[model samples]
Target: MAAKTYSAQHFVECDQCEENPAQYFCKNCPGQLCKECKTEHKNRKITKNHEITELNTKNEAFFGPLFCTDHKTKQIQCFCVHCKIPLCTECIIESHNGHAIQKLTKAYKEIQDDLQKKKEKIEEDLLPKYAMLLKTENLKQSDFSKQAQEIEKEIKAHTRQLVRIVKQVGKNATEDFQAKLHKGLQRIVDSEVEIQRKIEKLKQTKDLLSAKIETKPTVSSFEPVNERLLDEFEKLPVLPKYHFSKFQPGKIESMIEKNFGKLPILKIDTAKPNEGDSDIDSQEEEVEEEESDSEVPYNLRLVQESRRF
Candidate 1:
């Protein structure tokens, strides 16, 4: 069997021996060394107490800038809490003198804990409250839309009723004017008939008187005819003067328009905090009375106007 031969495949050769595979890395010396050379490197006065790590152990200190920029030879090992900056021994002593400082590892853990608490607050409390508010606002929006639709329906109904009322008023006015004109004209026609009868009697009387004067040629005949004429004239009826003023549509239109303009405003009536059932019932009764009173005019006026017409 062939003896196992040592080879440096993944790792480099020791910096001192250049023969054996490196087993440890010195952070202060900043180099890899074999076990034999590592012992020798540790015993040296200049390298003694230098931080050393195994080759397999991943150390971030060896991968990046460890020395402070201002103090070229000093390592950056501490974090300044007050200034919120990384610092070395010299930086702490000079610029960040007496400032609250901790080891970088400890500071990093504390910062991570604080960030976790903030994340929990956002996820558990703040975000859920905002979500509830958003939900409430959405519900309010839906309610508002429903209310708007209801108001639109009410407005349409009121407009239709107003139009009906205006039409009825116009029809009533026309019928009333026609009725009054018919009544007046009838009275005039009756008076004219009576006057015509009287005129016929007067014509007969004049013819009789003219015949008497031609036959008798006496003043006594004149006296009898004159008396008859005077009596007939007294019995005759004087013709009546009938006058019908033109219907003023503007006045009726304005009145109907004013009534329509008084339509109630639509609104949401919130329940009173202290109101009881009795109060609510009273309010309902008042509303009923108002509605009944409002309808009275339409009923009574329409009936009365129809009768008059």
Candidate 2:
């Protein structure tokens, strides 16, 4: 082989001489070796049995056995099937005797494949659902503001016909309407925040899995993949339902205050069906007077509780 040049800033030094760039790695010693040192390393009686390999980080790390955490001097040789943990020679004899065991390399490859599947699931399934939910929440926010403005217009138009005393009542009603509007919008806001948080969490998990899968598989990664990742993502966030009260203009009867109608009472009908009808449903609020014969309460149903593409 021809001589290879070395960069002063970025090169691993030979473990034996510490003066020349290394060209090989010994898995037995787990150390770097130069061309001259590699020749001498293979000649010695005791050290001659050491296994030397080309100085490639990925190949060396993957092929070499990992040291046991419990028994520092012993290399991990197998995986305990029942415990779902890597085991060294000492571990097999002392702690995991007679336990089912499998080759470490095989277990490492299986884990790598499992992690790849998890990363793909996040990318292909969970992310799109959250993106759609985010879009729907934004549209609902805009629609709520528009509907509230329309109801305010109805109140203002009716307020013009009442006297000073009735106008005061109208003012109070408008203030109350504003307060309710704030509360409804806040519900939508809270849902949006929750969906956004879930989306970010899924993205981070996807990135982590991708990174771990791309890099060389380690002993930690060889352990069983957490089942919760798939279980938790199977459930998407549930959008909240909102109740909006429509403004009803009271009747201005004779000049006597007693004859003038009282402010409209807002009632919500929980029995109304709002789901399983469509992908996106927009229902308007029904406004009615408290004394009126009609018992139908106001219904402000918007968007399905859950949706599918």
Clashes of each: 0, 0
Candidate 1 global CA lDDT score: 0.49
Per-residue lDDT of 1-309 in model 2, one digit per residue for the tens? 354555534356787887777778887887779889999999999889998888753353544667788999887888898899998889998989999998876666677788888888888888887788789779878977887788777777776777555565456567667776776777678878888888888888887787666544456766677878778767775565444555544446744233323333332222222253343553344434344364332110101111111
Q: Which candidate wins on lDDT? A: 2
* RMSD from true fold, candidate 1: 48.7
Q: All candidates' TM-scores?
A: 0.36, 0.66
RMSD of each: 48.7, 11.0
Off by over 4 Å in 2: 1-61, 243-245, 254-309
Model 2's TM-score against the true structure: 0.66
lDDT of 1 by residue, 1-309 (tens): 233346523345678787777777787767878898899999999899998887642344433235566788876777787876667788988899989887665554454444444445445644454344344335544554454445344434444554555555545444443454445445445544554554455455544433442231111211212223344343222222222222222333455533432222222222322233333423221111124454456434654454544
Clashing pairs in 2: none
